[model samples]
Target: MLVLLLLWTGCGSAVPPELAPDLILHNAKIITVDPDFRVVEAAAIKGSRFLAVGSNDHVLNLAGSQTSLVDLEGRTAIPGLIDSHIHALHFGWHITKHVNFSTGERLTVESMVARIGEWAKNVPPGKWIYARGPYSLDFVAEGRLPNRWEVDAVTPENPFFMNMQGHVGVVNSYAMRLAGVTKRTPDPEGGKFVRDPKTGELTGIVYEFPAMNPFRGLIPRHSLEDNLNAVRKANEVFNSLGITSVVNLAMPQWEFAVLRQLWRDEGLTVRWTAMLRADARVFLNKPYSEVEAEMRALGPPTRFGNDWLKINGIKIVLDGFVEAAYMREPYLEDIFGKGWRGILLWDRESLKSALRAAGKYGIQVAIHVTGDAAVDVALEVMDEVDREYPVAGRRWSLEHAGVMPTEENLEIAERLKVIISTQQSMGWSIGKTFKKWWGPEMGGIFAPNKTWLQALGHPYLKAGSDNRPINPFIGFWAYLARKDVDGEVAKPEEALGREDTLRLYTSNAAYGIFEEKERGSIEAGKLADLVVLSEDIMSVPEDQVREIKPVMTVVGGKIVFQQGS
Candidate 1:
């Protein structure tokens, strides 16, 4: 059936043989996430952009003999997904540089200890055995993090530092001794060196950068070549998931340096814009004046590079989530007693100075603020900055606000015209944690994606997976099913429909990185980036959505990944 459906023209007009499309994909459902959400039958690509998006006959006729043709065999295709927030460099290092203890199964305390035990024998005593896990300790079989003593059993001499996520970790006694962390050592501001409550002894458990940096600083930095390779490996994984573009929320100078080198060498696979971190550690104890001077010196301004790679903003992770999300009210289960709300990483004045500096350089600021109280503080700072110099249309974002911030704060964000960059994908994974820490009342508001969408409007609310498993489908399933780890629907009233969820990861996500005009939707003149799915995502059972893998991934008219290739 050669359906002559022309997306734009309505009438299929033939072009001259000399002006034919370079490539055509026909006999497939092309879900063009345009204003009308048209479902076209085919698409034509010329150079690195779309020439036409229509029916099989409309596009197939436009392909010349020299043009390439891919018969999709009735598969469903959508625009290549754009991840609004990712830590690709860190993810890369997690996979390549560090010793990974995950193997498609849950890690028990026994297996994790044994894995490190084997790896320690290869290296010298002083060497740091930096091991990474798949996701957090929540994913482990023992249902808790392996103790420091268990790690010490593996490596008595070496300083063993094993982390689930970067923030939460366990370190051996040797590592503790080497870092000068003792039972008497005081807790760092905004981070914790967790100790036994009854025993008053160091448990060797660490939380946040402040507490972890001591041991982290001991590890040697990866070389430029190592980082470049890590980025390549990370890109491969992203491409496999049909992700063509990403906005890295927290990228270090060295990682950005590696990416820049990749861009210069034409070695990049995924499109990304890095948000350089405003390191709290670097400016710690320094006054606003000194910090402002340093920030003012950050050159090249924002949006410095080209399409594939650019420095678009500065990221400030304001507070920790789960245990320490800066909250208005006290936590349901106060890990730290005394009716504690979460702690802010930076003081009020320092935060204001950082924002002021970023504004001076016309840099976009995306603060990682999860709790409502943190959002309040961030908005107050932004409002102050706006009073100084209007940031009305600057695209400053509140990363992870969709998860915890109240509807009122979201409304404030809307009024301020601030973007809400969130990880809809993390809902299912972190839902139980929310329940345990924040209780049922607070946990019910896990991912109010609908509320966020209604408040911020569609384009202003962007989506991404902040952590592994980095599959966007996990988020998609969570959004569609509204299910948590226990299969309980979290915040059913705030749940989203299929199309709306797709918009978040596609058109909406593209807008987050300020690249919507180029490649978010399937349209003529847009970059030819798309993914052919293994099944019809629109018709697939919500439970099976996570299994819908990408058959082929195309970026800028180039096929970057193909299954069974």
Candidate 2:
């Protein structure tokens, strides 16, 4: 026992004799989220890393004069939550700087217009009016996006642009005129300018990123201070929710730079894994290759940056959510017509070229795939690349694998060793609407968490909030209940147990960002990223999971947030 104690205490080695754990938490349930999913009594942290995890007695022995002991009082502790896919930059900008349409009551066109008008009143004239999100198509009375004329009528003098959660955008006439976009202006490749069917007049509703860019570029960029504040505010939200780490879905280069600056200034509070976006006209003014060259020249390869900020991979939006996921089956007849299969944002050759380039650079690629057809194309390209470039170590992932990943596709995903990162929380908000739109057969499989879990298990399968409805608890509830907001069970058999669901947000998410060894679980020598919950989420009544809140959030062994303190 003396020898064991000596070795554990760093005795007869490099110990300075005075070194001891800075903090310790004991007398509570600690969900380790290890391979065995052990639940221990206590944990000790030395500096930024976990010192030991065992019984309260064992961990207490590691404590010294400087140790700050915390009696958990039977509260439950788990690994700090990891949001696998969130738009931290956009989410921050929306929450801090833009007019948030999600905060108030049900948003009709009048209400939306009223909100915009109210916001317009506060800003100086001629300053571009920008609103980031309020992306619910169901909220509008017409079941369509807000019209340009409605925005024109409200914010007539100011050039206005509202980005609707990546689906589409509404731009006022002033904004359009500023961008020189008129009825005669040709629709850019990979996007559309929504026009009236009869009159051919531009409807002011822009579809996809490429098309929205012309007008969206007219908006003035936020000041650096605004950017910093936005990140800080977003970090607070994450800390409050027990999220210590996030894989930002598509952060701009400028925002990434801001985060790096924050890290240098000791302002970054959360671990950020950025999936750099190569969207045309937004961040990249040149072709994809030029952008790739710049990124390669910029020092860090995938996962090369520090603990706080790392560039994980590149984000390629293969298709839009609605009307453009490249489906195998013809979409059920809609305005586009019968046999209207969706469109792919990039052609097969172009996508292959991009994948090859990423592989050459040794950077990982995260392709946004929604349709099964898109998945099929992705698999083919990956298979081809594997034969040539051999991406076994790259950890390339398919983001938002979409609604229809057939068993064959799942097998291919597994065989090819690509990860499927999806957001099940989408079902809670958009499942019923999609079910009605796509018909039962197609829409029933929205998210398909259970199916993916059954096939890939927790390791290859990763879950994210996607910020569609950013509440992680709501995501937990959705997975457990397997039901949408309207109490409709899309696929009950696909529901997961509480433990598996927890793994989705914890360990699996860590693997998705290629940081599985660094933080995800409660383990010795790992970063002391943990959350103490109001209740044991594992043992709570399945329905009560959403009710449980984080009582404490600890990052790098520092108490970042404490309930009531």
Candidate 3:
């Protein structure tokens, strides 16, 4: 019956001649996220590339006897999803090792300490305990992080470190002592060691990665096999969610090796773009000349490796996130101190010089500028470097421009051709805290999706999940609705149209990694990476967007995931 049906459909008088396809999917709402955003009836794939796309009659004519035909029966098919920014290793390790406290409801001092106490029972005495958080200072009933003494009460023998959203960290006394971080230990450059004002004692709260790295360095990483297994597990999850490509950020050389090995071993199922970190021990604390020489040794600017795993570029953190972000204006209330805006992790001259050095090596740089002030600094740095290099297609990205860029700054970004790789997951998961910390005025303006769309337009603006919730649907829902957990809208005017939001994670994302021409859309000649969804996301009710699931995810014309598989 299948062969008979194909014979009837494939034989058409006056049909244009076409090549045979390895696979044919018919009766689908093929959302070709192309320039015109065309929707077609069917698509045909030949050996990892899209063979033809158009009405069923056109595509079916391309199918041969060997073509594996699939009748979608009116399912929605889209380009396989892309996560523009994620810490794959960190996410993988966390998923395997720790319990998540990102939901806000489970983020109290009592609850965290109790969970730690329970976890300590299994850990050997004097061993390290690490916990990852989506924690905020506002989430706790006390409106502050728990003290070391409080954490100590639960695990006096076991040293513990709670990593809070990559910005702040809480350490028990045992952990502090292990690192020898006494009250006399001076604050590191570009980082703060929170201390009690009255007693001048260490509060055990470490702010910024620079400050936390000393203690963090003491923890032993998982074995190579374990890390690889964790990444495999994470990829399984990513594939299940229709994520075919991810730009994994802040990857040091070692982690990149692991991912490369996974690809070589055929264990990698998702396309990975690893952005090298500048602060790896090899570059950190080194003179500019040394760092430049080291980066130059890494090879050329063009992406290296095959479609599965490739080196994207360099990543650097210029500032913190959330309330710790270095802002031009002070927060609604002074939480750090009087005149406390936030921490500037690099001096203007040093930052400019570092950027120029990276540019000299022809390396694409991705800067973590979570604040508007930091965004300005990053733009200035980019401008300086671009002038020095006089190169086009630099495509340096600004990761997590948390605050909405001013019109003038957006214009600067356009002029510089910088990609705005921001996230909507932050709003969906932490919108309430943003309001409480930054006040209604600034918090409501947090992402400013609509403003960005109007200013920078579609091609330059790409949305990332940041892995807080790790659900792209939540990112989709966040951008479309702009609503908090309470259903209170934050800058409802900034909500994006459904098509624009979809592009944020699709074609624009491909553009971010300079893969726009190769994949990202269900167009003929593009790589056959696509997803079949249970519901049509474009026309679905806004609230129902989050509940939509991928029935199948195909990468390189191979089905990597299917519902119930």
In order, candidate lDDTs are 0.80, 0.79, 0.81
- List runs of model 3 lying over 4 Å from the truth: 1-19, 103-107, 135-146, 182-189, 193-203, 280-291
Question: Pick by TM-score: which candidate is best?
Answer: 1
lDDT of 3 by residue, 256-354 (tens): 888978888865779998888876445555678876787787545648777988886788888767767788888777766676687777767767666
Question: Mind giving the per-residue lDDT tens digits that candidate 2 earns over 132-192?
Answer: 6554564455566678898888898898888876767888888888999999998886678
Candidate 2 deviant stretches above 4 angstroms: 1-17, 103-105, 140-142, 182-190, 195-203, 280-299, 333-338
Q: What is the C-alpha RMSD of each candidate to the true structure, in Å?
A: 3.3, 3.5, 3.7
TM-score of 1: 0.92
Candidate 2 TM-score versus the reference: 0.90
Write one digit per residue (lDDT tens) for candidate 1, span 49-109. Answer: 9888887866776766688999999999999998888888877887787778533356788
TM-scores of the candidates in the order shown:
0.92, 0.90, 0.90
Clashing pairs in 2: none
Among the numbered candidates, top lDDT falls to: 3
